[model samples]
Every structure is written in structure tokens, then in C-alpha cells.
Target: MGLSYEELMDKQQWLADELTKSIKAEFNKQNIVIANGIGRNRDGALDFSLSISDLDNPDQSPDVELIDFAKAKMKELVPDSDANVVGVPTPKQF
Candidate 1:
């Protein structure tokens, strides 16, 4: 049976938290934010996207190795999710 929308969202949230913790453990100084979403891809398969951003240092370049590591770890956590990681600027706070 397919997971309900809420269950998928919960899983996404859990994955995000796990990724955040894992990354932070290695890169303690960086302000890392891991945002994730679960949705269907073009082929209608379950897919996910993880956005890893440094909120405090947007100008500084992100570490490619770190992103790759995060992607790998995310994939290990959810084998079914075709997870993609991208760097995005932090939204301006009001």
C-alpha cells in the first residue's frame, strides 16, 4: 500500500533531521540547513529533494565534498528516494 501524504511528509522531515545532524557532526562551524520534500517525479516514482544551505555565509562557496557526502548519506537512509541536493540562498528574514 502507498504511504499517506502525512506519512510521507513525516518521513521527509525525519530524513531532513537525520541529514542535518549527520552533516553538523562533521561540519560543526557551518550554519547548515537541510530542507527536504517528498513528491512524485516525471515517471510518477517517489522522489525527494534535499536543499542544503549555509544561512550565515551565503557569499562563501559551499563545499562540494560536503554536499556529495550529504547526498550519499541521504540515499543510504532512503534507498527508494531519488534524492537530489542543491545549494540555495537563505530566505531573508523579516
Candidate 2:
């Protein structure tokens, strides 16, 4: 059975918090930020999207290694959770 709405929401928050912690630990020196959101996919499944960016250089995208690390951590953190996790590149903000 799939997770209920409340469970999904909790999972979303948990995933976001964990990802944020992992990134901070791995890139302590850089002023990095993580933007995360929860939404439903076409199939009605809960999906989580995480964006990583650096404030020092907003134009530059996060390194591929960092993205990979987040992806891996997401899998390890919730291997069988009912939420789909996506790592998106942070866009430059004005």
C-alpha cells in the first residue's frame, strides 16, 4: 500500500531536511542553499524536487559530483519510500 497523504508529507519534509544536512556537511565552506518542494506527478504519486545552488556564484551550477552525492544519499535514506526524489539544478535568480 502507498503512503497516506500525511505520511507522504512527512516523508517529503524528512527527505528535504536530510538532503540539506548532507549537503551542508559535504560543502561546509561554501554558502550553499537547498530549495525543495513537494508535488504530485501525473500518476498521482508524491514527488520531491531538490535544487542546490551556491550564493557566492549564482550563475554557476552545482558540481556534478555534488548532484550525484545527493542522488545517492536520497536513495540510501529512503530506498523504498513511496516518494519519488528528483535533483534539479538551481537556476540563477535575479
Candidate 3:
């Protein structure tokens, strides 16, 4: 059976919080500024879309690369949870 609504909400919250912290750390390390972000837990995975603007041009596309460390960190933090930072490097994405 699928998870109940309450269970899903709790999982979503936990995943978002954890993922946000990880990504935010990465952004800070790279001096990237985030304008907006959205997180969702679906299909038993945590995913997010973050709008980060470049340090040179805050109004333009920001560097949005989650470091390799972040991926390893997520796995360590949530051994069984499938957490991922989803972003496509393209003009349309920005």
C-alpha cells in the first residue's frame, strides 16, 4: 500500500528541509544567490527546482551546480531516501 497523506506530508517536509540545507550550503560555497526555490517529494524521491542568479548578474542566470560533495552528503544523511537536485543547464531553464 502507498503511504498515507500524513506520512507523505511528514516525509515531504523532512526531505525538503534536508535537501534545502544541502543545496544551500553548496550555493554558499560557490557564491551563488538563490532567488526562488521549490521542493517536492514524489515517487518516493525528493526533488527541487532552484532559481539561482549569478553573482556577476543577480538579474541573470546564476550558477546552479550541485557539487559532488552534496550528492555524497545526501546519501550519508538519508541512507535509504532518494534525494536529488534536479536542474537542466539550458537557456530555457534560466
Most TM-score-accurate candidate: 1
| Candidate 1 accuracy as lDDT | 0.74
- My TM-score estimates for the predictions, one after another, are 0.74, 0.68, 0.38
Which pairs of residues collide in candidate 3? 53-62, 54-62
Write down the TM-score for model 1.
0.74
Residue range 1-94, candidate 2, lDDT tens digits: 4455676667776777788788889867356676766666446776565677766666677777877888788778876443444434457566
Best by lDDT: 1
List, residue by residue over 44-90, the lDDT tens digit for candidate 1: 65667677888677755457877888888877887666656777777
| Residue-pair clashes, model 1 | 0
Q: Model 1 residue 73 lDDT?
A: 88
Which stretches in model 3 have alpha-carbon errors above 4 Å? 1-8, 29-67, 89-94
How many angstroms is residue 84 displaced in model 1 relative to the true structure, after the best TM-score fit?
1.9
Collision pairs in model 1: none
Model 3, residue 58: displacement in angstroms?
9.3
37 Cα displacement, candidate 2 (Å): 1.5
Q: Write one digit per residue (lDDT tens) for candidate 3, span 1-94.
A: 3434455455555554565566666555444433223344456543433333334443444333453444565566545544444433324333
lDDT at residue 15 of model 2 (Cα atoms): 77
Off by over 4 Å in 2: 1-4, 40-44, 81-94
* lDDT of each candidate versus the true structure: 0.74, 0.67, 0.46
